[model samples]
Target chain A: MLLCGLTLLHALVSGSVPIPFATVLQLLGGQAADPAAGQLQTIILQLRLPRALAAMVTGGLLAMAGAYMQVLLRNPLADPYVLGVSGGAAIGALLALMLGLGSSLVSGGALFGALASMLLVFGLSHRHNNWYSEQLLLTGIVVATGWGALISFILAISPDQQLRGMLFWLMGDMSHSDTPTLEAMLLLVCVIISLPLATRLNLYAQGPMRAASLGVAVQPLQWTIFVIASIMTATAVQLAGAIGFIGLVIPHIMRRVVGADHRILIPASALGGAILLLLADTLARTVFTPMQLPTGVLTAMLGVPLFLYLLNKGRRT
Target chain B: MTVLSCQQLQLNVPGKTLVSGLDWDIEAGQFWLVIGRNGSGKTTLLQTLAGLRPAAGGEISLHSQPLQQYRRRQIAQRMAILFQHQESGFPITVQESALAGRHPHRGLWDWSDQDQHETVFSALQTMDLASVMQLPVDQLSGGERRRLELATLLIQDPELYLLDEPTNHLDLHHQISTLEHFSGLAAAPQHCVVMASHELNLGLRYCSHVLLLYGNGAWEAGRIDEVIDPERLERLYQHPMTVQPGSHGNIYLPA
Candidate 1:
């Protein structure tokens, strides 16, 4: 969390028009003494601060969701998008863009799409007196595949003028980072609600039947995890346009450090994911000087090798 | 008092019946061994009794209440089931896994209390897992994993235990000790044990009652002395068998 705070501060000051550390601190403390530094103050407080905070929260949300899904499904490859919420969101966002809608409308459509997907998975997986975990898993995978096809179809038919922006969103750009309040609230709420279920989630990692035998109320618990993870993923996708790698890799990395106790691993994953994405976003902003790469690209570039290194190191020991 | 009772319980697959019209009563302090050939629905019968599977046709009552009336957690507090094997791709320490058994007694989100910790500790010690409490369960051998699974059952401390193949992958000594421990648990007036095992002699030695499942949906449940014999054993397995009166119990062997 300390590193996350520091990274947020560094991101706030290291933008195109760099603000000195002292001025940044003064502005943060509600005292911008010099009238000459008005632009710097505006940039730091209004623009950079919200964007940086949004990046951190989005990263934390995605990682936490991924951790829950991995345990809930008992699959290491499970991620925030495993249930097709992201694919649904992407389809909605892309549809909005093809119709030349505003960014807010696009995000709203994305959230709507995600909700539809969640309901679809939930409804199809539930049958008369039988809520098998495998049924849910298979349903989610098929729904995600369906949404992926729709997203591709949208991309192919979109007009040239809107294609660049759509592609940036697809690759996960934070340049148009939405307001952070809703995302921040969701991040806090998800963490608070999931903290209690963390221990139960640990049992679930063994298998659903094992968890059921251990008194976990496995069906209800699995449903709760699916909803929480879906909400987190939807909120993050709406804010930052489907960032990757943090969700898939951060929980695995944190498991090695925190030893797979969901209580510690979930929170640690939140913080670690926040730091990682904050650093990646900052690097994305500054690496090419005047131009910027999509933050998702940088996350994968940085994450894949680091994750592989950790896995290899674990195997050696 | 009768702890578990099923009337006309029938277990079946899609096109065939495994066991039918089976009526049985399990009282407190009774240990029952359910024996059958492979594919004869021993696991299915145990699962149905544990409320893990639906019975084809019958009413199963726990503590005289309809089984479906109790919530999953309520049922868990009353009974624990040990599967033949547990597989996890994730890593969890032995102690942590054993402590998961306290879930029925602890509130949701609450950590294990001191009494719960002591229970898990003793369970670990009983299974000889005390020396490797901190080791990841994935690192344990097959026998060790089986013992650890038994430790989890011990930690659950439920009124009834439904164990299927409890002694699978265990060494001879561990198997004997584990069954003896189960019999000791079943000696209490308010507790009972129902195990499905292929080891006819061991079941004969430890269990007071037997439920032999013949392949053609036929079954007999009674005191071990009355229910198990050379004739029934041979009929159940569809093979010739020899029975000997051993010092401990009847020895069943294929002739």
Candidate 2:
């Protein structure tokens, strides 16, 4: 959390209207900067501040969600978007874009579609409390493909004007969010996913038979966990477009330290996720001086090498 | 004292009839061993009796109430089962696996309370898994995992125990202890323990009722000596056989 906070602060101060770290700190402390540098300080304090904060929340939410997914499924490859929600959300946003719904409406459309796909999966997965975790897993892939096709169709027909913003947002950017939106997204993430995921998710890692024989209503619990996970993924995808790998990689590392015990692993994973994405976002902005890079690209660039190393280590083990 | 009665039970899986009309009264304080050749429905019958798989042909009643009316959890509170072998999703601690038995007692997403934890601890101790409670299930040797499974069932505190091959891979000491444990349950006049066993000698030595399934699906269920008669035993295994009786009504299975 501290790392994330620091990175956000730095992102604010390092923008075009460069505010010195001291002035940024002073301005954040509720005092005005020197009269000559007021425009520079205000630009950093007002404009870039919300954008940076949005990046932190978006990155944190994605990474935390990814960690939860990997641990819950016991599938190292799992991410927040492993199910169809991301693709479904994308399709909704794509439709909004083609229809000229604007960015504001597109966000809501994506979230709504993501949740709807999740509900469809949940409804289909439950045979009245009979667990179809495997079934749900397979269905997620199929539905994601179904939505991806629709999204592609919309994108092909879309004009260049709408396509430009859509493409940039899809790659994940912080500039899209202002202060109020970022705060609302943060509140939503906290309130919706605040419960102990580690404790509840242990059921899946324990296997269906063992969980059921031990008295867990496997189907209902399995659907509920994944639904919650998908919702978080959908929220993040809606808030900042699709950011990858933080969800896939972070929880796996947390598992190495915590030994797959959800009670200790879940919260630790959330902190790790928040910090890692915050660092990635900061690097994205800093790596290119004038040409701004999407944080998603930076994350992928960083993740590929790290994931390769972990994969080799995992194979050896 | 508690009794488990299965009346005209039929367990069917789609096109196949695993168990066709299994009827028996598993009275309280009796140790029953179900013996069958592979694919002869030993595990299926056990699963049905334990209410893990719903029977298609008949209804099961617990303590005179129809079993279907009661939820799986309500039934689990009164009966516990130990499957032959159950592997978890990954490496789970022996204590965590054992405490899973307290699932029926759990209200919603919560760990075992103080009283429940103590009971589980005692169960672990009884199964000689106290020292390795924190060890992951995948780390334990096969025999140790088997004992850990027994401890899981022990925590249920049920009136009856339904087990499928309770002693699959155990050292002589643990095996004898397991048999002795059931023997004691048989004599206690309160608990009813039913298990599937391939050990004929152990079955004759400990169990009060024996249900035998022949290679071609023929079955004979009754007293030990009655089912263990040389003539019937030879026909079932399709070989020459002899049963040498011990002083205390024990039947020995000699090679």
Candidate 3:
């Protein structure tokens, strides 16, 4: 939490136009009054503050969704996008961009696409009143592949004028996010709701039969995790446009630090994810100065090496 | 008192009928060993009895109530099952794994209290795993994993235990001591055990009753002595059986 606060303050103070730490604090404290400080206030409050919160919320959401997905599929390699949710969202957002839809409508389209993909995977994998994890993984991967094909097809036919905007969204840009409040509320609600199921989730990670034997309603719990994770991934994609590595890597990192107890792992993953993304976004915007890099690129570049190192270290130990 | 009862129970795998028209009553203070050749539906019957799988035909009742009518948690609180195969997908401490046994008794948002911790600790000690409670389950040996499974089952402390190949992967000492522990548990009032096993000698020594599956929908259930003999054992295995008289009892061996 201290790290989160420090990261947030750093993000607020450092930007293309560096605002002094005192003025940033003054603006945050609701005391910026001078004409010069007004512009600084706008820069801090309107631009950097919302972006920081969005990064935090988006990061936290993706990480929690990843944690749930890993358990729900019983695969350590499972991530939020493994189910093709982002592919679906990408298709929807790209289509909205192609048709010149408003930004809000693009988000709505992305959400609709995500839901469609979720239902597709759910329907395909559910049979004989059983939702087998292997079946779900296979079906999700196939559907994601199909969505990927569609995404490429859409990109090939899109107009050149809107191509840059579409590409930025695809690479996960945060500059367009105007509403972090909804995403923040979602992150809060997900953490609140998921904590109660932490113990059950621990049993669930063992296997479905054992989990059932241990008193978990395995079927219902599986469905609940799937739905909650899909919504989280959808909202994160809607807010930040397919930021990738936070969801996949943050949970594993947190698991190493806090062990596999969901009671601790879940909250720790959320906080860790928030901090990592906040730092990543700060670097994404300020490192390049006037020319902003896509936040997802920075996450992947940083996350890949860290993940590989962890994997190698794990094998050694 | 009957702890679990099944009427005309049937179990089947895709192309084979394993057991059919089986009526069995597991009374309190009885240790019943399910004996059969491979694919004879011992595990299937145990799973069906535990309500882990649906019976092809018949009714399973726990304490005079229909098993289907009970909620999963309620059923879990009354009955526990240990599978032959155990795998941990994630790294977890032995203590955490054993603590999962308390899940059935705990409510949502209820934390494990001191009593549960003590219970888990004792179960770990009984399984000879107290020293390695902090070790990740994946790092444990096959025998240690089996013991961990037993410890978890011990912590569950249900009225009925349905264990499929409970002694698999266990060392000789652990196998004997674990069976002895289950025998003791079954000796207590309001507790019963049904375990599927391949060890006929151990079954004879520890089990009060025997359930023989013939792998073709035929079965015999009665007191161990009444249902087990050289001739029946030979027929059960479809091979010649030699019985060596030991000080404790007859040890049956394939000939």
TM-score to native of every candidate shown:
0.95, 0.83, 0.98
The segments of candidate 3 whose C-alpha lies over 4 angstroms from its true place after superposition are: B113-115
DockQ of each: 0.69, 0.40, 0.84
Q: B19 in model 1: Cα distance from truth in Å?
A: 2.4
| Reference-based lDDT, each prediction | 0.86, 0.71, 0.89
Q: Any residue pairs clashing in model 1, and if so which?
A: none
Evaluated on the second chain alone, the candidates' TM-scores are 0.96, 0.88, 0.98
- C-alpha DockQ for predicted model 1: 0.69
The candidate, 2 or 3, that scores higher on TM-score is: 3
Q: Which prediction has the highest lDDT against the true structure?
A: 3
Clashing pairs in 3: none
lDDT for each residue of candidate 2 in A52-77, tens digit (9 for 90 to 100): 66666665566666665664555666
On the 0 to 100 scale, the lDDT of residue B240 in model 3 is 100
A best-first ranking of the candidates according to their TM-score comes to 3, 1, 2
For B84-145, candidate 1 gives per-residue lDDT tens digits of 76767588888888888888878765764566778888999999889999898889999999
Model 1 TM-score is: 0.95
DockQ of 2: 0.40
TM-score of chain B of 3: 0.98
What are the per-residue Cα lDDT tens digits for candidate 3 across B1-255? 998998998898999999999999999999999999998998888878878889999899988999999999999999999999975678888888899999999878687556688999999999999999989888899899989998999999999999888888888999989999999999999999998999889889999999999999999999988888899999999999998998769989899
- Cα error of candidate 3 at position A221, Å: 0.6
Which has the better DockQ: candidate 2, or candidate 3?
3
Instruction: For residues A202-245, write the lDDT of model 3, one tens digit per residue.
Output: 99999988998888888889889988998899988888897877
